[model samples]
Target: MLGRTAATPVNGHSANNNPNQLALPVNLPPGQQSEASIVHQHIQEISNKRISTLDYLRKAHEGRVYWFNTLLFDKSDLARMPYFDSRRLARRATNHLFLGLSLPSVIDVGSCTPLEFLRSLNILLSEYDAFQQLHAEHGSASSSLSRARLPQMFRRSAPGSKVRRTSNAAEVGYPHDGGDGGGANGTHNNSETTAGSTLGGGGGGGGGNGAAAGSAAATASAISLAASETELLPGEEYTHLLTPSIPFEPDYFETFATLCDVLIDTYQRLLTLVPTPRECAGNGVAELFTKADGKLRKIIIQGTVKEFEDASRQGVKTEVANVAKVVLGGLIST
Candidate 1:
């Protein structure tokens, strides 16, 4: 009877297969240096396979950023406390998808579609309406503001004018002055004028100090119940003073601090994990096992996820020629 020799295979693959297959030099193909690290070995493997990992990474981040970007659309979700919208904020989603994907030099985005432009627009409009409706029902409860049961702060409705409780949102009125639009003096003057005229306009008997003192007291109380950031107009629902909403939250505003913090924390984690260009360099491409059919899934590195995301969002056509040079040592294509 013939005995199996060392060259015999238990399966179609060499019996020598092991997780450390990358560490062994004999398994490495030609062109890989003897001093190759696990990363370098994988690079050589990818080179032999010729996969398009760059396109996958680019599309992945593009998909994620598409959603994140739409979320950033101005006042898209204004009613939620901790509202966050900004390019910098969108960076986190882009970073996280790349880092969590086992980013070796070679990437294999086996099969997936990049996020679409139309989907991004739909997300923005839908979320904006949802957040606003949430506010209409729950008011400050959903906003980052503590559940202070704070009385509705509004710009006082002028006497004989529509006393309808106006919301800070539009439908109440057109946008306020093209700014934060609030000041201590302006707030004081308006509250006093409205209170005196509306409550005791004709009761001018002899309450000089009394009326003055009462008016001052009322003004102070109103100021405390609501912040002095904007003039509050009276409304049936006790709407809080509405300030101008912008399409993007700048870096400085304190009102959106919680939202900003969420983005900051997310981006910080992604930043910590992102690979440097040198580390991401791969010799070529490699095979990762697929879960569905237990078959080898090829991964290739074309560029960094960031490079792909920026290019896709900007609508630049990324040509793949000469990608190996860039992935191996040159600057990642943007």
Candidate 2:
């Protein structure tokens, strides 16, 4: 009985050097009870411990420091996460890394672990690269398709010559009498004879017929010139006309509208993520979390939207640049 305490032993015996000695009854608080009375208590404790371990595992899996430390120090499973589809989390990590590095006021990213941040950053970068590749490939394909179809878009000349016709009365102003000089009243005309003599004594009627023929030839030449010059240049006016007045080619409009829609939708979605100027400044831990969250959202949204817009803009510029190449090629081939 020297060192024995009034507690139950596993074998229901006290440490009194006697196998048959029973343990003494212990003093109990109001809620305290024997081990058997607290049913499943050990199991509950083990379950809680398991939950805590799982939580730690999840945090490590999602953390930026986990990735960085693994890469820089441990060389573990940093490469296992599928970065392409996990871009949202990756983007969040990137924001944290930059904020930690660049922001003077952000002395420490409290509670936000480094491994989680790095993993998110890696995912975001992967997504951005994928998007860039897609945009480039799409733009190249679109340009080639447009170039292939450009020849069919050449506007043919209008059905007839665009020249204005002169009046028949203007062409036949003088009478068509024989070479002998005569006036409209059937009288001998000295003035008309003098005019005719200037043309080697040709009759006035011959001069009139010659003048009419020359006018007709001039009209024909003018019509030919007009017809040759009537094709429209590629410009706003031409675009407007082509949009609705001409045949609606699905390819042209579909590509253009898709680009515009991507730009506008991205912008709209980004606007939702940006914080107001007031929310950017605060002190409390809760307020700081809110601010950080808002800022992170804005950064991710803006980055994504800007990337899309830039891609679309570059695609359009490339398309335009290819127009000259296609035109030159057409000219050479023709």
Candidate 3:
């Protein structure tokens, strides 16, 4: 007991104030960080810095005009117009650029597996179908719909914007490449030929069979015929998905459409890349995350931009459009 050092007092309480409580070290040694931990910390710091910089930039230039091509043409009478105003044009261009860049965060295409992608795509596709139906039914001039149908979150326009602006349906440029029609799958093309040959061969043998055997053969033939008409090859199964009417706000209609556009475009591109079963089996999932560049990337980016243009014309929801833009860009990049 004499060898033990006296407990030092800290503020009003001494270390010995609570005899039952085990005292903690005043100067605890720092934890030894693993290589991975150090790397993680470094990455976290970098990410935080990047986020801070972006936030600062956003706040700094919130309503400023950026002269992308001002020297090429002088400010005209049209510049005074609401749509043609310099600040509005600049904001649109900036939003469009940011939208493309934010796609990675929007969808995280790189991390998702093929099955996950397909499932996500199925949801978006259904939503898009429902939106189209809603538009057809209620988005007409004669339809007395206004902000009443919109959700409370989206009914009111942002400050400084007009309450009810005229919207024109703009033409969307979908990738219409004639060669991209799953002809390369080979299975789809030969299905009819193969079924026809099987039917012909089965019918030839049915004539020689006894009454009971003939009945069985006829039943089998009927089943095969039905299957031949309805069956889809692997990977082509998405075509059979029944798009149900999912109630969504008009605010999200454009977003759904854009997502479907990207998903379909990406799937089509993947189909072209993987023509045979063996090749598809190996490269199908791997290629989904491949960084798309060169001409393929360019085409996808252009399509995304076109979606934005169409959305803008159709009274797009600003927040949702931004999210869609990011998702499409991410998909193309991934």
- Taking all chains together, each candidate's TM-score versus the true structure is 0.18, 0.16, 0.19
Q: Report the C-alpha displacement of residue 289, candidate 2, in angstroms.
A: 14
Higher-TM-score candidate of 1 and 3: 3
**Candidate 1 per-residue lDDT over residues 1-334, each given as its tens digit:** 1222433332234434433332333344444433334543444444333233333233343343242232221233222223223432332222222223222111122111011111222232233233233232223435343233223333332323332222233223322231122321222223333333445442122223454636654644432222222222332121111233221223222322332233233223222222221212232211211110011121112223343344444432233434555676645544
Error of 1 at 147 (Å): 34
Candidate 2: what lDDT? 0.31
TM-score of 1: 0.18
Reference-based lDDT, residue 200, model 3: 46
Flag regions of model 1 displaced more than 4 Å: 1-157, 163-214, 221-260, 266-334
126-210, model 2: which lDDT tens digit per residue?
Answer: 4333322222212211344334533432222222213222112222433445533332323322223334444454444453354
Please give the CA lDDT of all the candidate structures. Answer: 0.29, 0.31, 0.32
The alpha-carbon RMSD values of the candidates against the true structure, listed in the order shown, are: 21.1, 32.7, 26.2
Tens-place lDDT per residue, model 3, 32-145, is 223323433433343344334333323222322222212111234224334444333432332222223333332455313333443344443443233222232222213234
The candidate, 2 or 3, that scores higher on TM-score is: 3
Give per-candidate clash totals: 24, 13, 1
Predicted structure with the largest TM-score when compared to the true one = 3
